[model samples]
Target: MYSRKKGFISRSSRISCTTNEVTGRYSSGHSEDNSNETSNRYLSFRGFFRTAHGSSKLFLGCQNFSSLVGTKSGIEIDSDLDDGFSELEGPTVTGGMLETNVETELVEDDVDGEDVEMPHDKLELSDSESDARKAQVPEELLKAITTAPVQSLDKVMVNWVEKGNDLTRADITIIMFYLRKRHMYWRALQFSEWLELKKQLIFTERDYASHVDLIAKVHSVQKAESYIEKLPKSFRSEAVYRSLLGHCTSKGYTKKAEEIFNKMRDLGFPVTSFACGHLLTLYKQTDKKKIADVLLLMEKENIQQTEFTYRICIDAKGQSNDIAGMEQIFETMKADGMEPKMITKSNMAKHYIFAGLVEKAENVLKQMEGEMHLACRYLLPHYAALKKADDVRRIWQLCEPNARIVECMAAIEAFGNLHKIEEAEAVFDKMSKEGKNITSKHYYPLLRIYASHNMLAKGKDLVKRMSERGCAVGPLACDGLIRLYIKAGEVEKADSILQKAAERRFVKPKVVSYLAMMEEYSKRGDVHNSEKIFYQMRQAGYVRRIRQFRLLIQAYINAKAPCYGIAERMKADDVFPNRTLANMLSKSDPFRKTEASELLLYC
Candidate 1:
């Protein structure tokens, strides 16, 4: 409806303003009025005074937690987050959050003191800013793109770069930002072409190395290497080579990485920590003769070796029956006044354990304490595959009170290989009494053990503990919880867990989660949620999953809902969801019940 006398028109959409052609003033509108078309994640972050939200470390460092806006002032911190992760622990990163807050202000209104369209643009890109009362898009993209789906922006970027008419230096930077974000690897080849057109393009040495890092962040290790190749001779610095070499190693390009090591020597770039780590990782994954040849090559090239050079020998001989060689290297390292790293010592211990010299391994474990204790804590589980609980306990005692959660969890996990369920539970029970809150770290392992032991109720209790402790329930625990629900014939509880997994974007709602949910809907014949997820599975791009589809179809049948041709459609497609879902379908399909029915009948 509109006022006809003044010829006024209706205003709509969220944060959308109507422009007056004559005055150029924004027609004021309702912020509350919004539709799904404009419900951007970043926009909602700003509607809450973008400054406060940006400056808060929790929201900045956190992932997928922007949905917490609707909740009251309460944060359910996962034990696995900063609190539990002692390795990356330091003072809470409030400063980064604070900087984000400032960035948020820049978003709401431009620095020039003018109103922009919506609150979503701040999180979007802009080329530059200064103290002014005018807001402009600058005809360029922003850096550090935090968009949800970089894939969605492919068409936009392809059009902009191909035309090359509507662009600025900042625009190119935005291009790099998006390219790196989306890992649009093909775009780099285009960039190389643009560089040829205008010898000096947007990338300078100062930021080129960083751009390489950005590419690595997006998992474009090969692209990162390619960019290094294109860097001009004058601009090709040591920092550039180091970044490329690091990327090569990360991407498992062993041959290219070795070549980079030689190039670094030729360029006379200092062999920093990065160079050592990369070269050593490559040599470790290769043969002993190859590693020896690499060392000789380094010597011939006049490139001095770093302490990590010895790691090659350690990796080669460690955890194997090569006891004599490891002993000789340890003796040489001591004689050379180059302290054998704890890794070397731990590797020696691994050899002892492999050789079944339990007493010698125990002596080595005793001798290795303090910081080295942490390294050995990780090693003990591998060696303890053949040893006893006392050996594991001895190593655990050597570890600092704040040993890595992975290391601690490893000790608990090693129990299964030894068939030590009660002992494993005993450690968990002791940790509980000590008030050491077991999180997802312990949750999955304990759940698996319980399920294997037929202690379904206990597994469910562990999941409940995980939920209450604010531990993120992962797929493993979800499986255990569903199994418990099935054993007790509590299909409803199982379905609820499956639905929870689907809501949180768990990669694949395994047969456990899917089956339990389907069974619940089958027992009650409830097809509403079942069909919704069937569509959700398609929306999530898992439609070929026959198991998931069949679950929905069978649930519909049980509920007397209709899914008449779904079975044929599934088989017409890939006709398989996953193993578990496929099994369920095989059992329930009356027409082709060969696999599932045979298993059911025989079992």
Candidate 2:
């Protein structure tokens, strides 16, 4: 079992407290009021500050923690970080707690033949110094981790520690938060695993939840579940289960998510808005009919509705074309003392645009003024839907001077939707000329425009330019390129490009890309290539959905080829066909003619 040290709070609380202290210090130029609070808080070190002769190597070539703490009185080390210091066996100093003290240790200086004072493994820091150091720690760690190559993260962290930097729980909390905010889940998971292996900080439920969430994102939900099972029982709280549930919901595994939800209830954990919100979101996508039941249950449980909860409800109502109902929910949300967030308003406006209620959308956009960087993306598309080219142009102009990347992409889409291909091209050209840090995603809208308009030559040119400019030709680009080739009747070229991309270990084609190829091959009665793509998809570890199987069977029927073991194949893949697929299966059956003849004779 892992150590259950009580001195450490959950990661969230630590971050909140640290943020308050740092904000206070920077705002007032002093954190005198927070000094006592800082002294009482504990900080953990990972055995990188030992002063014993021939002891463990020092971090980053620093002789002691004095440089990090600034002065001897800046920090005070205590022995209460871990209970009994049980892991500090032999000459290795495992971990220590930092609290408040003015006492300093003195040592004889051999060179000067005089006594000198050295800090006692500085843990807690004084007001101004500690707050500044606290703010700086995350910056240094983020720079080190993000700048290094993925394979070198562990070595880089080790080098950082060896440089005599303090590795506290608070630093890890802030770093992980930033890593996740930037969507660097793989690197975040790697950092978490490294921390655990090095026994840096004691793991809490919050840490386990974050780890499980990252594993689900970077690896698989199955792997996440396995990791959860191995977690110490005390750490398997609602947050961990809900993390798994949220991912399952995202993947639309309704049954699995419901099972997790039931497990949460069986464990006697109170169902919060977070758990119900996932359920509502899942049902909103898969089974909108079940949304009412979830909301009713939330009301029955007396759970206070949060912004997310109301947003999902509003979306459900809007999607059902219940404009009045959606407004009512919005009013109820306000009555519950919750103001609508930007995303909530954006979602409502999106539904309004879809419903042809442009005036309502305009009103929502009006409320969102001063946040033009955000609201402009919404406005461009809403105006595009109405074919208001002038309005689209006006909004696109508003995005100038400091337009975000997303707004630029939205403008391209809005222009494309209005069939203003030249305008879209002009926007793209401007982005390129301005050197606006375009990524592969910026290419997608224009590529899609060319594909939809059957401008195969233009699509090919853009893709070539992308390659020449060192932009990544990822799966989405490959998908659009494949569509262009198919539209131009160059099926062979499409297949060749997809195969090359798949052959490269770094680029995995999207499921839609594979499906598009399979569908074209099926239409041509090319059962062999269809089946090849099918198995390649499986080998690539893409989830084998029923749609792929449907396309494969269509290829067999179109070819008049008698497919063998199709039922067994589907069963092995745990994908049973529905009525339409079953009909197709009978048509492709090897013995179907004989069976029909036998039935005729019996009749």
Candidate 3:
């Protein structure tokens, strides 16, 4: 026997033990020594066994068995054992092995000869119980998990689960759906991984497909393919293949996309027009020839071509400079009872422009006038480039009523480029009356007209209006005003305007404004003020051009200052003076004429 506190028997007590084969109990006879009494009392072997009916039983040894030593009946035990085993043993027994028979009788009495059945516990819950478990997810916890940042999602989920919420499969499915719908694919993938790994939830094929799509979108196509390979063969279906093909086409992995497309065909999957359209668009960039093969494949596979398919084919033809091929595709598209989109018409106009067919381009613009405003914008610049002022006006008049701001602005720029001030002013006034918000853009074009035509009063009024409307006057308008002043020979007025514009910071002075001031100062033979303006322009980060350097060198020579250094400065800036400037410099400084001619060589 072992002491309960010490958990092991002490060595002082030595007792001999005998087993009863009949009763399966061990009987220990203790010594009659008082010094070892405590050890004998605490230490004894108890037989441990289980009944046939599966109930556990322990046969404890009698502490004092020496009282039965002289008796032939049975080993004498304590009063509790005597009462408990009275039915199994008589007042006398034959040998010590009879103790085993007695213990077996005790075990049979405890079991009562009854047969036991194993417990059958179900692993899965019923539908009602599952619903109740799903209801255990708190509304607040659900909201927090869905709305939390991706970085903090793990912490939020762990805290919710720790608070005794049962995150079941239904709850996880709902959360994943919400995340994917919101385009939070990365977060959805993370949540799915946590559910399957941490919670031991098994996901179905649809769930796995969602995971694969999220991986493809947030990570890469290669990672998504690796994930698909790891999945069971039954999970790879037509939907999964189509999704992968779509991603490949979007990323421009042309070779990988073709392989997947061919695999789909070999597997007897339906080739969809949407997938074909993406593949064809990819082919349009690198290999126009391959487009026909894809179209032929679609036809052979009985896959219907969409309007977008025809559009891609036409664009491919246009890219290859095959105008006749493009027109043929356009006719075939119309013959199929499909209307061409705005983008298709734009491509046609571009092809016409490439071929220098201005009339045909104008006709296409007119055809698209009521439906699109961008046509006028595209054709206006073309007309301006050809100096066709009448054609520019015609395109402007043909713009739709709902024309965008950029379209109107483009028309105004074209008019300005063609030197048609009246038309430009008319367009500006029309824009203002049509309730279009007149900003700085509208003022700059008209200001150019004013500068070119010497309309000083109008230019000043425009600048004043810009200030009154809380619109900062831009550099273009400032340049126009200063130029108008200089053209009018009002040198002092131009200098004052430049000075005020620079100091006020409402409008920063550009290089054009500085150059105009420098020219005016040079014209008045005020080389000091001219050089001052030139240095200021340089400090403003304006690159020193040959024309501007010529002006400065002329100013230095006219001022009779040391002029040799000007040529050296020009050479350092890589701006060699031209013939007119070289002759002027040679006459001004005859000693350095050869140096100027040599510097001209570097030009």
Candidate 4:
């Protein structure tokens, strides 16, 4: 038997276990007259115990308390209830109260049992947890992770994970990809190391290669080597070695690159064309002999040479001025059913240019018309050097179809230099009509052309338009305007313009503007003003070049003002007078002609 005491269930002494059936119900064998009284006593004890214990359920061994107290008349009391019935009943109740308490405790236990089963139901999910992983990482999360401080990265990742965000292998890979693309290699390495230590991610060969490459780029080659050494032997494959070799070659770590290349060879890894090409390019300038060796090895090993292989070999030969060697390689390249790219054709043109065969260079450029736009900026200067102004114009026209801002600017400058003012103005107008952002660079050439032609009003109008359009007239255009005023013999006007430009802060005058003023003052034999302008240029932090010293020395010598000291001053400023300046000084001052001639030897 069980009885409640101080909110706890305790075993009681044996009680009566008698049953009496009435109307298909079982109950304790009590008199009908006392039935009502006993029922009342039982109900009162049950209510009191419930209020005292605050628990409606109790377990006594394997028997349920509610089963002992059957429904109303069906109640069956234990046979040994008399042992401690008095204690449970107290003064106002009978054994029925003990039975009711047991029944109530059992009811509470059943209700509590239902609560224990709830957790098991929650354990089953509708789908795989991994299936919830996103294909692409969230941009906001990526931005947060990337912008977070290096030390806080772990915390950021942890917080993101704790927020129920699923991070998959693909998501991790995307993060590393962006980090590497942005050259945030150190951060990528840190992320990779964290993933590795956590062991939550399974890294593939590509992932490992990214890590190794980041190590090489962000840390040192020695660390990269250590990382490779620590990698599982299965991960150290040809692709991994090739990635390392490529990094070494790019960084000019020749010895380390060679070691990696040889290690691959000794391990019997197949020599790929990319690997051979990288080594060839690295040694092109420093060691052509190695390039020859690599070419021979490629043939011996039955390795196929791609167009890139031919290009590197050709570049190698060109660097050595081996024009015939380059030509031979070019023929081999064609025989291999490979069409030369712009870079290949450019190399051939370079070879011809080196040999002074301008006609052959022009022919190569003609063949390269489809790709000439990319090379026109450099090619135009070469043509200008050869006195081929028509060729320069032809190249400019060829480049116009796909010309960007830089190409357009280059065309205008080229035309200005060649004195083709109409062509320069036409290009400028086209650029303006196309709505390309016109910066100060676009204004320089046209302003110089107008200034050189003595069209002062037109230049001033252009400056006004520039200001109206919110484009400040920069130092280059201002220098051109000042030079124009100087050329027109409007010295006072030029000085006023310089002062106004300084006052307005539209453009800070550069050394060129001061040099222009000095040249004008020198041409007028105003040595005092020229010297004063030179000193002003110095105060403005202009490092005096040889040309500035030459101009000032000539002006001083022209005025015959202690000109011998100019040579010593030139030496003091580390601006040695060249042959032309020495001759000018010797002729201008015969008294110091011997000293100037002897100083020329030292220079």
Residues 58-97 of candidate 4 have per-residue lDDT tens digits of 1000100111100100000111123221221134433343
Worst 10 residues of 1 by lDDT: 67-76
Question: Between the candidate structures 2 and 3, which one is better when assessed by lDDT?
Answer: 2
TM-score for each model: 0.43, 0.66, 0.38, 0.45
Overlapping backbone residue pairs in candidate 4 total 16
Clashing pairs in 3: 1-43, 1-44, 23-100, 23-101, 24-100, 73-92, 73-93, 74-93
Best by lDDT: 2
Model 3 lDDT, residue 249, Cα? 56
RMSD versus native structure for model 3: 43.8
Local distance difference test values of all predictions, in order: 0.46, 0.62, 0.55, 0.56
RMSD of each: 25.5, 23.1, 43.8, 44.0
Write candidate 1's Cα lDDT for 183-259 as tens digits.
Answer: 33334334534444555355555456655654553445567777677777877777666666665554334546666
Residue ranges of candidate 4 with Cα displaced over 4 Å: 1-142, 159-182, 198-201, 371-603
Best by TM-score: 2
- The global Cα lDDT (0 to 1) of model 1 is 0.46
Better of 3 and 4 by TM-score: 4
Better of 1 and 2 by lDDT: 2
Weakest lDDT window of 10 consecutive positions for candidate 2: 66-75
Model 2 misplacement above 4 A? 1-151, 166-175, 317-331, 334-337, 352-373, 433-437, 464-469, 500-508, 522-525, 531-603
